[model samples]
Target: MIEYQTSSFSQDEIRQAAQIQIQELPQGFLSSLGEKPLALIFEHVATSQFGVMVIAKESSNNRVIGYVFGATDTGQLYKDFLIRRTFQAIRYFLPKLLSWDRITKAIETLFYPARKQQKRQDQEECKAELLDLAVVQDYHGKGIAQHLFGEFVEQLREKGVGCFDIPTTAGLDRAHRFYEKMGAIKVGSVIVHEDRPTYIYRYIIQTRKHG
Candidate 1:
Protein backbone atom coordinates (compact mmCIF):
# COMPACT_ATOMS: atom_id res chain seq x y z
CA MET A 1 0.00 0.00 0.00
CA ILE A 2 1.05 3.56 -0.66
CA GLU A 3 0.06 6.74 1.12
CA TYR A 4 0.19 10.26 -0.25
CA GLN A 5 0.94 13.47 1.62
CA THR A 6 2.06 17.04 1.00
CA SER A 7 5.80 17.21 1.21
CA SER A 8 7.47 19.31 3.94
CA PHE A 9 10.39 20.22 1.63
CA SER A 10 12.35 17.34 3.05
CA GLN A 11 15.80 17.47 1.45
CA ASP A 12 16.35 13.75 1.68
CA GLU A 13 13.18 12.82 -0.16
CA ILE A 14 13.62 15.59 -2.74
CA ARG A 15 17.21 14.51 -3.29
CA GLN A 16 16.16 10.93 -3.80
CA ALA A 17 13.51 12.00 -6.28
CA ALA A 18 15.93 14.29 -8.14
CA GLN A 19 18.42 11.48 -8.44
CA ILE A 20 15.78 9.38 -10.07
CA GLN A 21 14.94 12.17 -12.51
CA ILE A 22 18.55 12.64 -13.50
CA GLN A 23 19.14 8.95 -13.92
CA GLU A 24 15.90 8.11 -15.67
CA LEU A 25 14.92 11.22 -17.58
CA PRO A 26 16.81 12.81 -20.48
CA GLN A 27 16.70 16.34 -19.11
CA GLY A 28 19.13 18.37 -21.21
CA PHE A 29 20.42 20.99 -18.80
CA LEU A 30 19.09 19.62 -15.55
CA SER A 31 21.48 16.70 -15.82
CA SER A 32 24.36 19.15 -16.06
CA LEU A 33 23.00 21.96 -13.89
CA GLY A 34 24.69 20.99 -10.65
CA GLU A 35 26.59 18.20 -8.97
CA LYS A 36 23.53 17.68 -6.81
CA PRO A 37 20.22 17.94 -8.69
CA LEU A 38 18.51 18.14 -5.32
CA ALA A 39 19.80 21.66 -4.78
CA LEU A 40 18.05 22.96 -7.89
CA ILE A 41 14.79 21.18 -7.07
CA PHE A 42 14.93 22.39 -3.50
CA GLU A 43 15.55 25.97 -4.58
CA HIS A 44 12.51 25.99 -6.82
CA VAL A 45 10.27 24.30 -4.24
CA ALA A 46 11.40 26.52 -1.41
CA THR A 47 11.14 29.75 -3.37
CA SER A 48 7.85 29.01 -5.09
CA GLN A 49 5.93 29.65 -1.89
CA PHE A 50 2.48 28.76 -3.16
CA GLY A 51 3.54 25.82 -5.33
CA VAL A 52 2.58 22.21 -4.54
CA MET A 53 4.79 19.20 -3.82
CA VAL A 54 3.12 15.88 -3.14
CA ILE A 55 4.98 12.72 -2.15
CA ALA A 56 3.91 9.11 -2.20
CA LYS A 57 5.33 6.80 0.44
CA GLU A 58 5.27 3.04 0.57
CA SER A 59 3.42 1.80 3.66
CA SER A 60 5.85 -1.02 4.31
CA ASN A 61 9.04 1.02 4.40
CA ASN A 62 7.80 4.63 4.50
CA ARG A 63 10.05 5.50 1.57
CA VAL A 64 9.13 7.99 -1.10
CA ILE A 65 7.94 6.19 -4.21
CA GLY A 66 6.75 9.02 -6.43
CA TYR A 67 6.30 12.78 -6.48
CA VAL A 68 4.57 15.67 -8.27
CA PHE A 69 5.58 19.33 -8.41
CA GLY A 70 3.36 22.15 -9.64
CA ALA A 71 2.29 25.72 -9.05
CA THR A 72 -1.08 27.22 -8.20
CA ASP A 73 -0.40 30.68 -9.63
CA THR A 74 2.71 31.04 -11.76
CA GLY A 75 2.55 34.79 -12.31
CA GLN A 76 5.05 35.30 -9.55
CA LEU A 77 7.07 32.10 -9.72
CA TYR A 78 10.06 33.46 -11.62
CA LYS A 79 10.01 36.94 -10.13
CA ASP A 80 12.54 35.99 -7.48
CA PHE A 81 13.91 32.54 -8.15
CA LEU A 82 15.25 32.87 -11.69
CA ILE A 83 18.46 34.66 -10.86
CA ARG A 84 19.56 32.21 -8.22
CA ARG A 85 19.01 29.12 -10.29
CA THR A 86 20.61 30.74 -13.33
CA PHE A 87 23.72 31.67 -11.39
CA GLN A 88 23.92 28.20 -9.95
CA ALA A 89 23.61 26.72 -13.42
CA ILE A 90 26.34 28.96 -14.78
CA ARG A 91 28.67 28.07 -11.96
CA TYR A 92 28.18 24.37 -12.40
CA PHE A 93 28.35 24.24 -16.20
CA LEU A 94 31.29 26.63 -16.49
CA PRO A 95 33.81 23.87 -16.02
CA LYS A 96 32.19 21.66 -18.64
CA LEU A 97 32.00 24.32 -21.39
CA LEU A 98 34.34 22.31 -23.62
CA SER A 99 31.52 19.90 -24.43
CA TRP A 100 29.45 21.26 -27.32
CA ASP A 101 26.45 19.19 -26.33
CA ARG A 102 26.45 20.65 -22.85
CA ILE A 103 26.81 24.17 -24.20
CA THR A 104 23.94 23.80 -26.69
CA LYS A 105 21.77 22.09 -24.08
CA ALA A 106 22.41 24.82 -21.55
CA ILE A 107 21.47 27.50 -24.06
CA GLU A 108 18.30 25.66 -24.94
CA THR A 109 17.32 25.19 -21.32
CA LEU A 110 17.93 28.84 -20.45
CA PHE A 111 15.76 30.23 -23.22
CA TYR A 112 13.09 27.54 -23.21
CA PRO A 113 9.72 29.28 -23.14
CA ALA A 114 8.21 27.47 -20.20
CA ARG A 115 4.43 27.81 -20.15
CA LYS A 116 4.26 29.43 -16.73
CA GLN A 117 6.49 32.31 -17.73
CA GLN A 118 4.38 32.89 -20.83
CA LYS A 119 1.15 32.80 -18.79
CA ARG A 120 2.56 35.44 -16.49
CA GLN A 121 3.01 37.83 -19.42
CA ASP A 122 -0.64 37.44 -20.44
CA GLN A 123 -1.82 39.22 -17.24
CA GLU A 124 -5.46 38.54 -18.09
CA GLU A 125 -5.75 34.79 -17.71
CA CYS A 126 -4.86 33.31 -14.36
CA LYS A 127 -3.16 30.05 -15.24
CA ALA A 128 -1.43 27.45 -13.14
CA GLU A 129 1.49 25.27 -14.29
CA LEU A 130 2.23 21.61 -13.78
CA LEU A 131 5.98 21.85 -13.64
CA ASP A 132 7.16 18.27 -13.15
CA LEU A 133 5.69 14.88 -12.33
CA ALA A 134 7.45 11.56 -11.98
CA VAL A 135 6.93 8.08 -10.61
CA VAL A 136 9.73 5.69 -9.79
CA GLN A 137 10.26 2.91 -12.33
CA ASP A 138 9.36 0.18 -9.86
CA TYR A 139 6.03 1.91 -9.15
CA HIS A 140 4.92 2.09 -12.76
CA GLY A 141 1.65 0.55 -14.06
CA LYS A 142 -0.11 1.59 -10.85
CA GLY A 143 -2.70 4.34 -10.47
CA ILE A 144 -0.37 6.49 -8.41
CA ALA A 145 0.07 8.99 -11.24
CA GLN A 146 -3.65 9.38 -11.80
CA HIS A 147 -4.30 9.81 -8.10
CA LEU A 148 -1.52 12.34 -7.74
CA PHE A 149 -2.81 14.38 -10.67
CA GLY A 150 -6.36 14.20 -9.34
CA GLU A 151 -5.22 15.60 -6.01
CA PHE A 152 -3.15 18.21 -7.82
CA VAL A 153 -6.14 19.50 -9.72
CA GLU A 154 -8.17 19.65 -6.52
CA GLN A 155 -5.50 21.63 -4.66
CA LEU A 156 -5.11 24.12 -7.51
CA ARG A 157 -8.88 24.48 -7.78
CA GLU A 158 -9.11 25.32 -4.10
CA LYS A 159 -6.60 28.09 -4.69
CA GLY A 160 -8.80 29.60 -7.44
CA VAL A 161 -6.63 28.36 -10.30
CA GLY A 162 -8.98 27.46 -13.13
CA CYS A 163 -6.65 27.09 -16.12
CA PHE A 164 -3.59 24.87 -16.20
CA ASP A 165 -0.73 24.43 -18.64
CA ILE A 166 2.16 22.02 -19.08
CA PRO A 167 4.99 21.71 -21.59
CA THR A 168 6.29 18.36 -22.65
CA THR A 169 8.52 16.89 -25.30
CA ALA A 170 6.91 15.06 -28.20
CA GLY A 171 8.67 11.81 -27.27
CA LEU A 172 6.74 11.36 -24.03
CA ASP A 173 3.82 9.57 -25.63
CA ARG A 174 2.45 8.25 -22.37
CA ALA A 175 2.30 11.73 -20.91
CA HIS A 176 0.59 13.07 -24.00
CA ARG A 177 -2.02 10.34 -23.76
CA PHE A 178 -2.58 10.94 -20.07
CA TYR A 179 -3.03 14.69 -20.51
CA GLU A 180 -5.40 14.16 -23.42
CA LYS A 181 -7.40 11.74 -21.29
CA MET A 182 -7.59 14.41 -18.61
CA GLY A 183 -9.20 16.80 -21.13
CA ALA A 184 -6.09 18.87 -21.73
CA ILE A 185 -5.94 20.49 -25.12
CA LYS A 186 -2.78 21.03 -27.07
CA VAL A 187 -2.58 24.80 -27.23
CA GLY A 188 0.60 25.12 -29.29
CA SER A 189 4.02 23.67 -29.94
CA VAL A 190 7.51 24.71 -30.95
CA ILE A 191 10.22 22.68 -32.56
CA VAL A 192 13.40 23.15 -30.62
CA HIS A 193 15.53 20.92 -32.78
CA GLU A 194 15.04 18.52 -35.67
CA ASP A 195 12.50 15.95 -34.55
CA ARG A 196 12.39 17.40 -31.03
CA PRO A 197 9.16 19.32 -30.50
CA THR A 198 7.92 20.89 -27.31
CA TYR A 199 4.17 20.67 -27.01
CA ILE A 200 2.14 22.91 -24.74
CA TYR A 201 -1.03 21.47 -23.24
CA ARG A 202 -3.66 23.27 -21.19
CA TYR A 203 -6.44 21.97 -18.95
CA ILE A 204 -9.28 24.13 -17.69
CA ILE A 205 -10.94 23.30 -14.38
CA GLN A 206 -14.63 24.07 -14.25
CA THR A 207 -15.66 26.09 -11.25
CA ARG A 208 -18.69 25.17 -9.19
CA LYS A 209 -21.54 27.64 -8.98
CA HIS A 210 -23.08 28.44 -5.61
CA GLY A 211 -26.74 29.31 -5.40
Candidate 2:
Protein backbone atom coordinates (compact mmCIF):
# COMPACT_ATOMS: atom_id res chain seq x y z
CA MET A 1 0.00 0.00 0.00
CA ILE A 2 1.11 3.54 -0.68
CA GLU A 3 0.28 6.70 1.25
CA TYR A 4 0.38 10.25 -0.08
CA GLN A 5 0.42 13.36 2.07
CA THR A 6 1.64 16.95 2.34
CA SER A 7 3.34 17.61 5.63
CA SER A 8 6.69 18.41 7.17
CA PHE A 9 8.85 15.59 5.85
CA SER A 10 11.88 14.33 7.76
CA GLN A 11 15.48 14.67 6.59
CA ASP A 12 15.66 11.01 5.61
CA GLU A 13 12.52 11.32 3.49
CA ILE A 14 13.93 14.44 1.83
CA ARG A 15 17.14 12.52 1.04
CA GLN A 16 15.15 9.70 -0.51
CA ALA A 17 13.16 12.12 -2.64
CA ALA A 18 16.39 13.78 -3.75
CA GLN A 19 17.81 10.42 -4.82
CA ILE A 20 14.68 9.61 -6.76
CA GLN A 21 14.84 13.05 -8.39
CA ILE A 22 18.39 12.40 -9.59
CA GLN A 23 17.57 8.89 -10.80
CA GLU A 24 14.29 9.75 -12.50
CA LEU A 25 14.95 13.23 -13.91
CA PRO A 26 18.51 12.88 -15.08
CA GLN A 27 18.19 15.56 -17.74
CA GLY A 28 17.12 18.31 -15.36
CA PHE A 29 19.70 20.95 -14.38
CA LEU A 30 19.13 20.60 -10.65
CA SER A 31 19.65 16.84 -10.83
CA SER A 32 23.13 17.55 -12.18
CA LEU A 33 23.92 19.47 -8.99
CA GLY A 34 24.29 16.15 -7.14
CA GLU A 35 22.27 14.55 -4.35
CA LYS A 36 23.36 16.61 -1.35
CA PRO A 37 22.53 19.97 -2.95
CA LEU A 38 19.28 18.65 -4.33
CA ALA A 39 18.38 17.32 -0.90
CA LEU A 40 19.02 20.74 0.62
CA ILE A 41 16.82 22.42 -1.97
CA PHE A 42 14.06 19.91 -1.22
CA GLU A 43 14.42 20.63 2.47
CA HIS A 44 14.16 24.36 1.84
CA VAL A 45 11.06 23.94 -0.30
CA ALA A 46 9.42 21.60 2.19
CA THR A 47 9.92 24.12 4.97
CA SER A 48 9.07 27.34 3.14
CA GLN A 49 5.64 28.96 3.36
CA PHE A 50 5.55 29.79 -0.35
CA GLY A 51 6.39 26.21 -1.32
CA VAL A 52 4.52 22.90 -1.13
CA MET A 53 5.65 19.29 -1.52
CA VAL A 54 3.47 16.20 -1.56
CA ILE A 55 5.35 13.00 -0.82
CA ALA A 56 4.28 9.46 -1.56
CA LYS A 57 5.56 6.69 0.66
CA GLU A 58 5.21 2.94 1.05
CA SER A 59 2.93 2.45 4.02
CA SER A 60 4.67 -0.79 4.89
CA ASN A 61 8.08 0.74 5.44
CA ASN A 62 7.40 4.50 5.58
CA ARG A 63 9.86 4.93 2.72
CA VAL A 64 9.42 7.84 0.37
CA ILE A 65 8.79 6.60 -3.15
CA GLY A 66 7.78 9.73 -5.02
CA TYR A 67 7.09 13.45 -4.66
CA VAL A 68 5.62 16.56 -6.30
CA PHE A 69 7.04 19.89 -5.18
CA GLY A 70 6.54 23.50 -6.27
CA ALA A 71 6.12 27.01 -5.07
CA THR A 72 3.16 29.37 -4.84
CA ASP A 73 5.42 32.08 -6.15
CA THR A 74 8.25 30.52 -8.12
CA GLY A 75 10.12 33.81 -8.48
CA GLN A 76 10.05 34.42 -4.76
CA LEU A 77 11.03 30.84 -4.06
CA TYR A 78 14.18 31.18 -6.14
CA LYS A 79 14.97 34.48 -4.56
CA ASP A 80 14.65 33.03 -1.07
CA PHE A 81 16.73 30.01 -1.99
CA LEU A 82 19.48 32.28 -3.25
CA ILE A 83 19.32 34.64 -0.31
CA ARG A 84 18.76 32.30 2.59
CA ARG A 85 20.87 29.44 1.33
CA THR A 86 23.47 31.67 -0.27
CA PHE A 87 26.59 30.01 1.05
CA GLN A 88 25.34 26.49 0.47
CA ALA A 89 24.11 27.27 -3.03
CA ILE A 90 27.45 28.84 -3.90
CA ARG A 91 29.37 25.90 -2.47
CA TYR A 92 27.47 23.39 -4.58
CA PHE A 93 27.01 25.42 -7.76
CA LEU A 94 30.39 27.21 -7.87
CA PRO A 95 32.22 24.17 -9.21
CA LYS A 96 29.79 23.85 -12.09
CA LEU A 97 30.46 27.48 -13.06
CA LEU A 98 33.79 26.43 -14.58
CA SER A 99 31.82 25.32 -17.64
CA TRP A 100 30.66 28.19 -19.85
CA ASP A 101 27.57 26.20 -20.86
CA ARG A 102 26.62 25.84 -17.20
CA ILE A 103 26.98 29.59 -16.67
CA THR A 104 24.72 30.34 -19.62
CA LYS A 105 22.04 27.94 -18.43
CA ALA A 106 22.19 29.45 -14.95
CA ILE A 107 21.70 32.97 -16.34
CA GLU A 108 18.87 31.80 -18.58
CA THR A 109 17.08 30.08 -15.68
CA LEU A 110 17.33 33.20 -13.55
CA PHE A 111 16.03 35.59 -16.20
CA TYR A 112 13.85 33.49 -18.49
CA PRO A 113 10.64 34.02 -16.55
CA ALA A 114 11.15 37.76 -16.50
CA ARG A 115 11.78 37.73 -20.24
CA LYS A 116 8.67 35.59 -20.76
CA GLN A 117 6.67 38.00 -18.64
CA GLN A 118 7.78 40.94 -20.77
CA LYS A 119 6.71 39.13 -23.91
CA ARG A 120 3.45 37.81 -22.50
CA GLN A 121 2.21 40.51 -20.20
CA ASP A 122 -1.26 39.07 -20.76
CA GLN A 123 -0.29 35.94 -18.82
CA GLU A 124 0.21 37.79 -15.56
CA GLU A 125 -2.15 35.34 -13.91
CA CYS A 126 0.39 32.56 -14.18
CA LYS A 127 2.28 33.33 -11.01
CA ALA A 128 2.25 29.87 -9.48
CA GLU A 129 3.70 26.72 -11.01
CA LEU A 130 4.07 22.96 -10.60
CA LEU A 131 7.84 22.64 -10.59
CA ASP A 132 8.71 18.94 -10.37
CA LEU A 133 6.65 15.78 -10.17
CA ALA A 134 8.08 12.27 -10.18
CA VAL A 135 7.18 8.75 -9.16
CA VAL A 136 9.41 5.74 -8.56
CA GLN A 137 9.81 3.57 -11.67
CA ASP A 138 8.21 0.58 -9.97
CA TYR A 139 5.19 2.71 -9.01
CA HIS A 140 4.50 4.03 -12.49
CA GLY A 141 1.09 3.25 -14.07
CA LYS A 142 -0.33 2.79 -10.55
CA GLY A 143 -1.94 6.30 -10.70
CA ILE A 144 0.51 7.72 -8.17
CA ALA A 145 1.38 10.67 -10.40
CA GLN A 146 -2.24 11.58 -10.85
CA HIS A 147 -2.87 11.37 -7.13
CA LEU A 148 0.16 13.53 -6.36
CA PHE A 149 -1.00 16.09 -8.92
CA GLY A 150 -4.46 16.22 -7.40
CA GLU A 151 -3.01 16.80 -3.95
CA PHE A 152 -0.77 19.58 -5.22
CA VAL A 153 -3.70 21.29 -6.89
CA GLU A 154 -5.72 21.06 -3.72
CA GLN A 155 -2.92 22.62 -1.73
CA LEU A 156 -2.68 25.46 -4.23
CA ARG A 157 -6.41 26.10 -4.07
CA GLU A 158 -6.28 26.21 -0.30
CA LYS A 159 -3.58 28.79 -0.61
CA GLY A 160 -5.89 30.88 -2.84
CA VAL A 161 -4.18 30.27 -6.16
CA GLY A 162 -6.45 30.50 -9.19
CA CYS A 163 -4.04 29.36 -11.89
CA PHE A 164 -0.66 27.71 -12.25
CA ASP A 165 1.86 26.99 -15.00
CA ILE A 166 3.88 23.96 -16.05
CA PRO A 167 6.90 24.11 -18.35
CA THR A 168 8.10 20.93 -20.04
CA THR A 169 10.64 20.20 -22.74
CA ALA A 170 9.43 19.49 -26.28
CA GLY A 171 10.47 15.83 -26.55
CA LEU A 172 8.93 14.67 -23.28
CA ASP A 173 5.76 13.32 -24.84
CA ARG A 174 4.69 11.35 -21.80
CA ALA A 175 4.89 14.42 -19.58
CA HIS A 176 3.01 16.52 -22.12
CA ARG A 177 0.29 13.89 -22.32
CA PHE A 178 -0.01 13.65 -18.54
CA TYR A 179 -0.39 17.42 -18.18
CA GLU A 180 -2.99 17.47 -20.93
CA LYS A 181 -4.79 14.54 -19.30
CA MET A 182 -4.95 16.53 -16.10
CA GLY A 183 -6.76 19.34 -18.03
CA ALA A 184 -3.84 21.72 -18.43
CA ILE A 185 -3.92 23.91 -21.55
CA LYS A 186 -0.79 24.49 -23.58
CA VAL A 187 -0.43 28.25 -23.67
CA GLY A 188 2.79 28.71 -25.61
CA SER A 189 6.40 27.70 -26.10
CA VAL A 190 9.73 29.27 -25.26
CA ILE A 191 13.41 28.53 -25.64
CA VAL A 192 15.46 27.89 -22.52
CA HIS A 193 18.95 26.59 -21.73
CA GLU A 194 20.06 28.48 -24.87
CA ASP A 195 18.53 26.23 -27.54
CA ARG A 196 16.23 23.79 -25.79
CA PRO A 197 12.56 24.33 -26.70
CA THR A 198 10.02 24.12 -23.91
CA TYR A 199 6.24 24.22 -23.85
CA ILE A 200 4.32 26.15 -21.22
CA TYR A 201 0.94 24.92 -19.97
CA ARG A 202 -1.56 26.58 -17.71
CA TYR A 203 -4.10 25.02 -15.37
CA ILE A 204 -6.95 26.98 -13.78
CA ILE A 205 -8.44 25.68 -10.57
CA GLN A 206 -12.23 25.63 -10.51
CA THR A 207 -13.56 27.10 -7.34
CA ARG A 208 -16.27 25.23 -5.49
CA LYS A 209 -19.54 27.12 -5.23
CA HIS A 210 -20.98 27.55 -1.76
CA GLY A 211 -24.63 26.62 -1.46
The TM-scores, one per candidate, come to 0.78, 0.95
Global Cα lDDT for candidate 1: 0.69
Residue pairs with colliding backbones in model 2 are: none
Clashes of each: 0, 0
**For residues 1-211, could you state the per-residue lDDT of candidate 1 as single tens digits?**
8888774656666776676566656464565554364456554764466677777778787687777777775545644456557777556447766687767764565455453356446444444678777788888879888887887887788878888878778888999998898788887765544348778788888897899
- Computed on alpha carbons, the lDDT of every model, listed in order, comes to 0.69, 0.88
- Cα-based lDDT at residue 186, candidate 2: 93
Query: What tens digits encode model 2's per-residue C-alpha lDDT throughout 76-193?
Result: 8888888898998888778867788878888888876676677568756587889899998998999999999999999999999999999888889999999999999999887876
Question: Which ranges of candidate 2 are over 4 A from the true structure?
Answer: none
Q: Score residue 118 of candidate 2 by CA lDDT.
A: 70
Best by TM-score: 2
The local lDDT score (0 to 100) that residue 197 gets in candidate 2 is 83
